[model samples]
Target: MTNNMKHIQFNNVSYEQWKEEAIKALKGKPFETLFTPTTDGITLEPLYTQQTVIEKLGDQLEKQISTIRSLKATKDFSSAQQIFGETAEQFFKNIEDSLERGNQILTIDSRVLFDWDETNISRLASILENNPFKLVLQDKNDVILTVFEQIEPSSRKQVSGYILSKEPIKIDNYPNVRTISANTLPYHYEGANVVQELALSLALAAKFANNENNFAEFVNKFYVNFAVDTQFFSEIAKLRAFKILWKAFTKAYNAESNIAVPIVAETSLRSFSKLDEYVNLLRAGNEALSALIGGADVFTVHPHDVLVKPTDKSIRIARNVILVLKEESHAASVLDPSGGSYFIECLTAEYVEKAWSLFLEIEDAGGIDAYEESGKLQRILEEVTTARLKSIEARKHSLIGTNIYANPEDDFNVETNPLFVDVKRLSTPFEELRLLYKNLQPKISILTYGKLKNFKPRADFVSGYFATAGIVANQSGEIDSIADLLNWINKTDSQYIVFVATDEDTKTILPSILENKRKELIIDVAGRFKEEEKEWVEKGLNGFVFAGQNLVEKLNAIAERLKGEQQ
Candidate 1:
């Protein structure tokens, strides 16, 4: 083989050319509608070019690119999976098993410390002496921190790990352990957008640093944790932006700007649902990849059933997601995989700029602590949470097995952790609705009229819509006349009946069926009849089910009606 490469020449298309083609493909839909606005107040364009990147970064484009590219010294990340067990022995066994299967860090939850005996503490100390660990402390109580005291000073010196806690911890001999954590997971769980998360995390770090007399020591022992969601490129950009923001933040304090801040990223549970739990696996995979490409120092994958009791299989699968990405895909072999892409670079820049501004705002408000104390943070979180829940309720945002495309037959009998009761998850409303319908066991029927072609689509829509709430609607055989519809409705025990047919057929037959049908049956129509809505209501139509309507609201009304009938 010669020391040469084959090259193929192709026509270089301008951004305008691409835009023109995209416009043509849009087929008269307003091209501006392609612009998507994120909750972070950033508008996402459909396409990004080198010119766009240049415009965003201005004179600092090359510097920004270089900074991001150099942010990670290595792409390798430790798999820091939490070991869950009800008892100390089981927890140790799980830790051993997880380590053997490629879990690099011994992740311990503080709650598990309550079950530890002297022997278990000894065993933990032994493990810590030889391995890296991550301890998640819910508070600064001495009881949980006492676990470190039991370890011999010599052994403790060999221990290397980080603690996830809001307060700073000082272990007598653990020199390699990082104590303070600036975590964005809480805000993320409360529905904070990417910019808010980044800014809040920085504000948290600033608070920690300001409280300490030694800024350098605080910087050395401080690490940040992020709950990576499934927004793929945006999430990758968010992480990258944090590094740039951290550099700027450190420079303001005259600290070393090049110092690397350790990032521990885990897949977010905000989008996880208990209904179609398996879909959570795909979500975790996507988030894990984002964390990998975005240069996290430690990555954790919460098991698909983490909301409930996680089985051994689910935990193993979660661990193997990282293993597969590393060993099979060789993603760890390259640093900054998203470094040069125009879109990612621009996005990273945008995040850095916006997040820095927000961080400054938070700092002016006396940091994260003062902001939280003032209740402003809680109010902001509430607003964002409401907006996000509304999106999920309206079906504007889709959670595969929770809000849209739900499995009506899926059983949700498993007990959930009480700890997650306060977690603001996107799927909670739909899950509650499903559970309500499952308990009610309402008898619903889809009363179809007209030919199969005309009625089947509407019938299917009504059935699927009800199925989302876990109500299986019985579809009646074709009814050609109003008398037949009335006979079926009267004979059946269904408390709710939905009329499904062509608009004209429904208009022709609905009046007669409503006039003759039993008074107790709550009748609704499948399609929207805007002009005739008031007329239909007066004629005894309960409601209408159509695309883009708020499914949660509609289902809640039906559920309320079911409750009223039961009473």
Candidate 2:
């Protein structure tokens, strides 16, 4: 369409030439520093060029990018979600409103035992007469299935849901109902990584696919559920990989090509933070965005405060996240918004390959049920879970408003146990530390001495670090005199005093401030002075807190000290 641009001439830079330029730009830093490796053993390069794509995927590079799809444009791309209520009447009303508010597929959690006198079931059956729906039969004993059984065979044609077990459920009468489901949430909540999650899903699908009686219809009737998190590119690649891997799994069964399985993506409760609850909004939004872009048939964004204190507004915001992404962002209109990108394409391939390997391993171990029963699945999940927790504590991974950039004055007034499911959360440790702060209101005084340049930066750092642990930081403006600083500390009645001045200023004023200090008050320095640390500790210095410090460990030690003092 545009020939004028083709006439433009420029020297094509070789990969080695570009690398030389990049190394020069890096100055003294090692070129290897640009690579980041994920737990799946995929090393990410700083830049992905055409040469890199060709080298990695070979002749498939061009075909891969063009074929990479986040989602297929199927059935007008309506946003689907599950609605739960206390009563059948209330749930009936919710269904009506949820559909009106742009929710295309409305799923009912099958645990709720409705007023099964046929009145409520009749009403739901009447609605299913026209619109499509899903029943989440997470538990085999969920009494709602009784009402479902009552539905006429014709009305059941439009309904779909999982049997929620390894063993297949086949109703002799309602043959149209989908009983086989790829249940991935159990492993997801147990902190399975992206690869493990995908592999587990595939393993479960293969189990159903291996069913001799239902082998032919399993791929068509099967539904997959997954927990989506806020790891932007990884989550996007995860969803896309699911489709790719699923197709490959089905291909072995001689199923139709490009058969897109119905995928339900729910935002991860483990990703929600209780400290700065507002930040959960961002986490949910990112998780929801990843699912929508990755091509999930149905998406559920859990309320930001769902783990602790979910309000009506929070629930509304959670549901509306999908709406906004679909309508406002117009993300639903694109088939694969993240496709064709060198980074995403490469990552997707890596994930698919790794996940396929794990699936094969699971298959070797006699499928998911046998592997899970062997306790190896639990051990592997625990390993990944531990690694993820360590990453958060070490600040290698960041959780805004929980582990980093916390708002000191934020209030966490929710009950210890909310009237909702007690989901496993990654922020539990940080939340416990903040709870101590809320209860004790421990005061930390910053003794800012020397010039503004010497102490201001460290003072701010100290203040923010304590805020993350919900500790109150009372920082005095630059006080050059040791007596003045001690006087301010006495007035504030701080139990912890941190010197925010320079190393030189701290060394000069150390003896004077240490003299006749409060016996119970813990003293600390803002920076590491290894040579002087032992001597300072001998002279009653508590510890050092600075950049790159293990803040969770440091704060936990402080909290323990405070607790002992209180006792």
Candidate 3:
């Protein structure tokens, strides 16, 4: 058993014991109630168990399944290997019971996704086959994605039908499946980015069509996303831009290949009012409407005041708002709700063109992997993100419940009638402290993106990194501007690991640096590196993000944080 496994033996504590003693130790632990983190965030469990899978789907399973299936026929049949009819029958009952018992948001943890001894995909399938849970396959290393071959034709047909089925009801692929989820949570939390999300998606979808072998299948598949954020129009514009870009991207590929790109909208975690908890619902509802009007396929806004432990009342009202939009207000059945306004189309198209251009720029830069390693992609994102942060800090761009209309009195301290925060919780204003300082320090970033053969870039990119970080840089080799920064980056303090980027940054440096240095080094890419330059960057690095983000901003943030420490 793993060391972590040795410690956790679950014997359910009585309410008072869990409340007053056991759960007390967990009060200050950091975890998002819902929505996965896009980058740097905690991964602690609110609770843990050896029996990872909940065997029974609780009480009201039958009714919920009947209701959902009655309303929507299942789509992606091949994907949902729910072979047991009785098990399938059991899932709906669990859903209704969980909902009735106040089990609002669902969970499928890492065990089913990643296990040391077993292949993740099959394991996930087993879990999935047993229970219909909403699982987010965000990590690139997810086990389910074992194959590198292009998606086949049969898969494409299944996916296309799946897309069409989701507009009104659920389909065959785990009729309960939320195939696409918006991952805006992490981007907003860490560096606060959006454009790359649109651009990279454009590139990947295109590459899936043009480059991959399974063009007959995977190319035809259209997946939607569920985004959770508090940005109103910015959120709306994001959805609008996605639709616009998909059209352009598809046009760039084979015509009439739309297949349908849908979006599932959620409220941003960064926007929750720590003060005015109630305003969160309003903000989320607005964001949802924007996504809805912007033509998203599915919409699930989070409960307001989720930053605090949510109450049953809060969840009820959050669902009610959607009900209002769907049933009472009649927002659900609308088509192309924002289709014709010149401002929206023009504005959305502008973002579309910008994203496409960015996509092309990535294509121009030699795809995803090449753009990332050269520090090209990270540098660009850094340039834009830095300006954004400056705007936010300067109050030029406003966050409704956050920076603007300040609420200082503990008036925002919400009621805890079954919704109180963990009394013994950790506290450091996420805005005020470096989350990593409690763990390790960070340094200037040089990303090795996409995939690389070796550890070559570390010696080259940091060539002049010292001077850039205001430290005198000295290198063992030539200090030309081309590879000096990369070499210099390698010289930074090791324990506090230098902040090299993730996607493009990981591999882009391999060939050049490896060849130049003549070193038998290894570049650690995620799995496989795309050979085509333009397509590589768009799909591989996803708009050139590295070090979990852009390089320069990472450098500046680390520098600023370090400088603050010295002060």
Q: Each candidate's TM vs. the true structure? A: 0.95, 0.90, 0.46
Q: Rank the candidates by TM-score, best first.
A: 1, 2, 3
Whole-model lDDT values for every prediction: 0.84, 0.76, 0.42
What is candidate 3's lDDT per residue for 71-184, written digit by digit as tens? 211121111111111233344343444455433233322222114233434343433343333443435454433321233433432222222121222233322233333343
Clashes, model 3: 71
lDDT per residue (tens digit) for residues 163-188 in model 2? 44445565655544557778788788
Model 1 residue runs over 4 Å out of place are: 1-9, 73-75
By how many angstroms RMSD does model 1 differ from the true structure? 2.7
Off by over 4 Å in 2: 1-27, 62-76, 111-119, 160-168, 172-176, 256-258, 308-312, 416-420, 486-492
Clashes of 1: 0
lDDT of 2: 0.76
Model 3 poorest 10 in a row by lDDT: 76-85
lDDT tens string, model 1, 51-134? 898788778877876676666633578899988887777788898999999999878877753456667767777788788989
Number of the predicted model whose TM-score against the real structure is largest: 1
Worst 10 residues of 1 by lDDT: 1-10
lDDT of candidate 2 at residue 6, scale 0 to 100: 68
